[model samples]
Target: MPGEDMAGGAADTGPEEWADARLRGGADAQAAQDPPETVRHTGPPAPGMVINARYELVAPVGHGGMGEVWKAYDTKLRRFVALKGLLDRNAMTGASQAEAMARARREAQAIAKIEHPNVVTVHDQVETDSQVWIVMKLLDARSLAEVLRSEETLTVPRAARIGLQILQGLRAVHAADVVHRDVKPHNVVVGEDGQAILVDFGIATFDGALAVTQAGAVIGTPEYLAPELFDSSAHGPRTATPASDLWALGVTLYEMTEGRTPFPGPNAWEVQVTIDTSPVPPFQYAGPLAPVIEGLLTRDPRQRLNAPEAEAMLQRLLDPRAAIAPTPSAPPPEPDPVPVRRRAPRGRRAGALALGAVLLAGAGWFALPLPGDDPDEKDGKRAGSGGSGTRERWKDTHPLLKIGVKDDQPGLSKFDPKTRTYAGYDIDLAYEIAERMGYARDEVDFTTVATDYRSTALKVKLVDLVIASYSITEERKTAPPTGYSVDFAGPYFEASRGFLVREKSSRYDIEDTSDLQTLQVEVCTARDSTYEKWLPEAGFKLVESPPNTYQDCLDKLLDRSSDIYAVATDDVILAGYVKENPGKVRQLENVGGAEGYGVGMRPKSPLLKSEVCASLKDIMSGQVWEDLYRKNLSPLTDRKNPPGLPDLTECEVQSAGP
Candidate 1:
């Protein structure tokens, strides 16, 4: 076989050359495939060395702008692995190889620190033949870019949920003070298990450290570059901040919903300039995502909304009563057809009939069916003719004080055998409130409620309190189930329903309605507050699934079946993906508005409300709430925990937007 056989026109070479061209960017270059230089490699298996104490010399996986990644297997581990070789191989002069090797080691160490469900794992790193070899978890999936090229855009809700997961991955890395300077679609991985994992921390930088990039040596793919990354002055004299990552995330969402970047140009330089100077337009998307996108893509990084604010915004968008603007679209033209129409009947007649008994009953009205009550259960639960006897039962033990939790949310399990206790955030919180009311934890009965049936259980008095990360809304507050009123506690943790996609996605530039026809968007559900109201108004033909959580949508995006996913902004599920695969999934921007998680009690239970609120006040004012907040949210919130807005901490702040 020719040396350049698989190198792509990489050598003006053929099919194999196609692979090489993909790696090197051209035919005759010898340097790695970095921009401005295209390099191709002659086939060769290095002559000396032991890998996993077996599997002798083999050829390179392929060469690229950065370096060459080899495909190999470990005889001992009995699995395939990818080994990455730095840009310069045996040709390094002096101690450069050693320095590169050190860098490789540092990268491995940094990767090791990240443990999440969506991150790719690093297995080993070694110095061989004057070159550095970094072995990483192998994946059978195609590059996110290739997948997008084939599948294009994904649904909106799916994109939003996936976006949230990506933020999670970034949160882990950011918590370690590392910045993934290069975030875009190509770096994300959609695993066989259908989760988007962030991969390739090759260009990541530690916060506050001198940039490894030389002057005029811009890093990262062009499309997802934050305006600040391109021109620090563009974002008020800052080079890049955590907010920059969010700006890039906004671009990613744009690409997913519009099927193209919000800013596009013929060349990288032009694209970078556009990114730095241009502004994203206001356009509605298939749900209530416009506001969410606006916050994510804000050019002024400082003015842009933070993750918590974004998360809260999304929760509100998830509300069912949040009205969506109607989709503005031209009516379909009348079809050309053959005319064989039928005429209407010319006449009709009717005769009045007399009743045999000639008896009339009084006219009466029937009430409309209430939301959660089944007809069968309603009749049986009706108050007895002896009203006084029934009233006492409802008033004393306070049947309304009983709180119920739904099983749909994660970490809400009833009990764990290993722990031998009722474990989960909700379980603990609910029991704490009950204890404050002077009731034993056991007094708060546990009954598994499916997410679909949760509301029904509430209407029937099956449970008194619901602490299942539920948000209190005006609609639910106004007309509650008979005798029940809705009361809330501290917003606690904030969250949102936003978009998730590959970091460098073309959708990054999508900030308006100017480009909606080219993308494929997936949504979690049609009833999702954001998408239901916004997508139609923005003029999108939405493809939605039955009601599902953010994670469900994430799984779809990772499978490459959906381009975008929607979920709580606070979810930051991307952390799991990054942990599972390493640096792939990411948030484009928050697609919705601020919403809070609160303790829901029947409005009728003033005693419960006052008692629970007092406990909350103490917690919020003291170390207990801080400890809990730190425990569950330190990864992302510790650094920027919002200060003293006791009133706004978990409460909704209404704002007007286009």
Candidate 2:
């Protein structure tokens, strides 16, 4: 009872959320178990305090981070309702207040858009001069928190029924790619008729937005937070995925049947570590409801039961004739053991399969030290580190990535127009990125993209990832919507600027860097190429003719329309022209470059960069990258050893400053 108020942490609703840590667990938890702070008579509101002229506040039922919730009467419709709106709007400064306002409206609109019985109905959201009020269907109810405090532990059948309804609501939320990051008993309201409705999306988040919580902190209750939350920091930005929510669901169900939370701690960090390390205790009273609970509670997001799978598992439990058996199929061989010490016992949940524990024991997870808590570091690794949940998130939405590869170019990504096939190191690298991102080869759909259209295709999202020997320049990377506004996976291959010109052309008269100023070399360059910036800076006042591709430059050179076929592209690409055209065109000699080839993606996608860089680094560390280079670029290399892998450090996204 001493730490009960502290244990029930408030759900944070952006900058507009009520500014108090004690107001945790959005609704009843903040009022019932914790201090009321300065809120007066949180019992019933005065009759005359109407909100937005449409709903009259009858009583203050509950309140939390997203301000006060009232039991109200809709004056227009003459029906009972719940009124939820932000707090201290005028107190907040400009941008912070605006973002919170947008977040509130977004949550209201998203939940209202979905039609599901288990989810509460959002009727309308009205913005006033000072505040915003969201009107929702009001149910005459005592919360699950009230039931838990009174009943202690629920019967197995009752808990399952409650969990089933909650899962249905979760399915609907996840279908919209939204995550209710703080799902606890406090957020659930059990109506008088025994219907449990999920409510309060104050901390609910969509995949499109970059970060869920603030930089260094996680928003949910300490006990219900998943182990994966510990892995994320400002260093490794983490968004809330449904898998994290499912972990909360498991904890909620556990609390319903067990009376006390599975992991009890005086502080939030200890609770997180306990979740990551300690064994999930056996379900004593949750008879047939054990498998899904254990499955959903796993630290590894990949192994955790997803929304659809968890829904199906819960559905089978509801049907009396189809009681689930843990191992309906034959037992398989034991998995190979993991490096981390698996000291926790394998408590029984489902039948003999012990699938969750057996796999968890061999899971081989890592945990890092949090500054002052750095322990005796051993074997160059730390215990209780968190896992990245990005792969599981991608599987739900964009498992099949549309990759942009050059259709006609050789050596990098080449697509045969007539044969309709793609081959080259860039194509191989794209498939490798998909593989490390938890996708199979067939899951990738390759599209033909010329060099000029690469940036455009990625900007409009016609392609999810592009690996067509793209350059990594500061200008392209900094360009807002059209350029490197997205993340880059590599400098997987490095190249310097070079020109492909005819042997008989006057371009050979250029001896050194200083000669570029005097040479009136009429250079044909590609549109959107970095040379547009690079050429003038390097003192080349050459008359520029922009084309769609370097191939077009070669065409102009061969047709005698241009004095010099010029480009500032990878040496491998210039070599391709020389290899294909015999003596017709040759690369400019002694011209070295400071550029690297990169895999490009949308601006705000962190996972694309994280997983892509992970895969690129992994392949380069082993024989895989060398083999890829030998297979595709070896022809261009003329059987010589192709360039060693680009420096791994070049591909990494620099950690934000502390």
Q: Which ten residues in a row have the lowest lDDT in candidate 1?
A: 348-357
Q: Which candidate comes out best when scored by TM-score? A: 2
Q: What is the lDDT of residue 499 in candidate 1?
A: 45
Candidate 2 residue runs with Cα over 4 Å from true position:
1-47, 87-91, 207-212, 233-236, 320-658
lDDT of 1 by residue, 456-542 (tens): 345434455666656556654674332233556666545654444554344444432233324534434322333444555654445
The Cα local distance difference test for each model comes to: 0.48, 0.62
Error of 2 at 495 (Å): 40
lDDT of 1: 0.48
Error of 2 at 317 (Å): 2.1
In candidate 2, position 628 carries an lDDT of 85
Q: How close is candidate 1 to the true structure, as a TM-score?
A: 0.43
Model 2: per-residue Cα lDDT over 220-305, one tens digit each: 78888777776664213355677788888999998886677888777678997787678887554554456567767766653455
